[model samples]
Target: MEMDVVAASELQRGGWDVVVIGSGFGSLFFLHSYLKRHPDHRILVLEWGASHSRQWQVDHQTNSAVDYQTTISNHGEKDWNFSIGLGGGTNCWQGMTARMHPHDFELKSRYGVGLDWPISYDDIAEYYDLAETVMNVAGAPDAGKVFPRSAPFPQQQHHLSRTERLIKADRPDTFFAAPQAKLTSNVGTRGACCNNGTCSLCPTGARFYAIEDMADIWEAPNLTICTGARVREIDFSGPIAKAVLFESEGREYRAEADLIVLGANGIHSPFILQQSGILGGDPGSYLGEKMLTFVEIMLDGMDHFDGGTATTGFELSYIDGEFRSRHGAVQYWTNNSFLWGGLRLDPPGRHRQVFPIGITVEDLLYKENAVVDTGNKYPVIEHSGFSDYAMKGLDFAISKIPEVFSSLPIESVELRRVLPTADHIHGSLRMGDDPTTSVVDSSQLHHHLRNLLVVGTSVFPTTSWAVPSLTCAAMSLKVGATI
Candidate 1:
């Protein structure tokens, strides 16, 4: 299937009903929901990267032609990672679909910590189910027991790993099969996961790639996709975003729109607003994410790599409770990536001994951490570091290492140094009711500029202890319903 890509020069006389910047899950899901409610509306999507097809990505063993470092100026110790192509982060995500717990929405109210989201989990619960079905999310049957859901998952649960099974046997209420966007069964051209361990570029196309799965919006008669079009800033005076100023093939162009959606990732979306001089409540302030950590444990007797996919089960044991009153919450994604995987088992019976658990600690966004534009194409990413709250969560999580895997005779649990980036960025242009505090409204529309909406994790006031993909999609889907 050929993408209906429009050339930049052919459409110099630009005018569109809706002009969305960035072609990520936030953008596609918003468009997917919007077009469903109001069909045949003119929509134009501006993506910074070219359309690198799925086959090309698998064949070349990469996602994009552009290097990630080349696009941004890094002034901090850590690196911010995200795919820049048409499908955006979906190209590189591990496909762990999760919903923010009810407490995540009311941090300040429930725990006297961070800001509370104007909306609650109950508001977007329907859309979470909608997105799950659209992606054919194969989740545990009892996931609804953990997080409140109105509907069951579209597909059945993935088989839990041996270590996970043992952990669940010991702590059944705390540990459960993780909800992922891979397939237990095939649907259309997409195949079931073959447990290749490399899900970033799924050779079987089992994971939900935006280009393949989100074709409802991409191939709609109402939408036009323009690749290699980098939006510089919005042309707006006070409340209205009149036009989008962008560059394509060394030439700058202005595309007028009735409504403009800034679906750019967490960092760039605020940078775009800052460059455009819309700085109420500091759209460039408080830019950071929950710190990413990996905790690995060597099992004794359990032969582990039996999951249907890479990361099969999840542990919500440390996610909530009174600890959140002081320290941030923590969540776990049990991964199958060992330092020495199935390839080289030096010992005769050391086939599946290494059990790696991916961990994320909830964080408080600091005013010092921010994204600033220094008159460059990309914004400079600078950070002070993680707050004491987040560090304490990590410390607490590490303290529970022996207990987390106590079912098995735990040999050792090591805290490998924190990874550079989890690709879960947040808290730039956050949502709230007050214009002096929040940049966007509860509906994700700008407080002052009502016509301009900022979608994706950029509007996330607080980062939860899970991947931001599913939450961001739910927020975008809600935006679509309101608009």
Candidate 2:
């Protein structure tokens, strides 16, 4: 099918009803749901990176880098590993689609740490159902109770790999098939997962990426997508965003819209607000503050090197319960595929049995940790050290390594500390009930600017110990319906 995307030069000279920046899951899902209600409304989508097809992504490994100027301090000189293409990080995500635990929404009320979300799990439960159906989620029916789903998954669970089965056989309650966005059977134009084990670059399009899923939306008569349009700033007139200034092909252009939505991930969204001078004083203080991410811990013990998706099963018993009182929640999963190709295992025959169990600890939000623009060429991400709660959680998770892996028959389990990378960067433009504490309201709209809305994980008040794409999609859908 031909995509109905145009260049900035070909854009029509008229104001759009809505201008959505970025083509990630949040933006696409909002457009998909919003257009269904109001099909004749004029909508324009602005994407910074150029589009890439599945064949092209496979041929290129989907690693073609873009030259956007952004940096991370206290970690590295380079910027966070964020995708800029049409689908953004969905092009490279692991496809885990777990929902945030109910306790995650009430962090402050339940655990006396972090801030509680303006909305609860019950508020977004229907949207999660819609997002799961649209993404064709596949998972075991047993996970329904633990995940608190409103409806059954659209697709049946994929078969567990031998490694996952082995782990589950030993510890039944500790492991279950992970809820993933990848399809198990053919759905519309997308095919079933071929189990090539390269989900980051799936050639078959079995995985659900927003760029591929938004093809029908792009073809809609009411929508227009402009690729390679890098938004520099939102020209605000008083409290409303009057126009979006962008650069394409080394030339600058402007697009006017009555309503503007920022779906440009966590980092860039605040950076854009700072560039536009909208974030200052109280809002600016909280703009890039309270950043959160997980500390990755790798374990060696299972045999999971066969052909399968990136992750088939996960452990969630430790994420909540009495653990939150002392430390944050901890989540672990079995890595089904060996993406690191060049690692040598101890002994010759141990390579097949040396699988990795990935552990992720929930991060507490801190006001001091922030992304700052020092009037330099690039934005500086000044992140402070992890909070005491987060450290306690990491330490607790580390202490449980021996007992958790004792069920499986393995030689030894090792812990390796990798360089910290910002995988799930959130809370730069967080949403809350109070304008003094958050940048946006519960509906994800700016408190001062009524017509400007911020979607995606950037608006998350707290980062739960789960993959955030599903939650982001749900929030976008809720906001779309409200609009």
| Candidate 1 backbone collisions, by pair | none
TM-score of 1: 0.97
Off by over 4 Å in 2: 63-65, 68-79, 169-171, 280-308, 341-345
Off by over 4 Å in 1: 12-14, 339-348
- Tens digit per residue, CA lDDT, model 2, 1-483: 577789999999989999999988779888878888889888999998888877788887763357444333333232355788877778887688988888899988888877899999999999999999888899878786576776888888877767667667777766788889888888888888877678878777788876677677878898888998988899998888898999999999999999999999776777778888887323323222121222222324445556346677787778887678778788777766554443335556556666566666777766666666666534566655556776687778768766665556655545554325536767888888887778898888898898998888888877778878899999889888988
Look at candidate 1 and tell me the lDDT of residue 21. 97
What's the TM-score of each model vs. the native? 0.97, 0.91
Worst 10 residues of 1 by lDDT: 337-346
Whole-model lDDT for model 2 versus the true structure? 0.75
Per residue, candidate 1 scores C-alpha lDDT tens digits across 1-483 of 666798777774658999999988889889878998878778888988999888999999899986877877889766788888998988988888988898899989888888999999889998898889888999987777779888889888888877778888988777878888999899899999888777889988889998898877777887888988988889997678899998999999889999999998888788888888888888878888888887767667656777767888888988888888898899888876652223326467775777878889999987678888888778898887788999899999889878777787777786777877778888889899889988998898899887998888888899889788898888788889888
Give me the candidate number with maximum lDDT.
1
Please report how far candidate 2 places residue 294 from its true position, in Å: 12
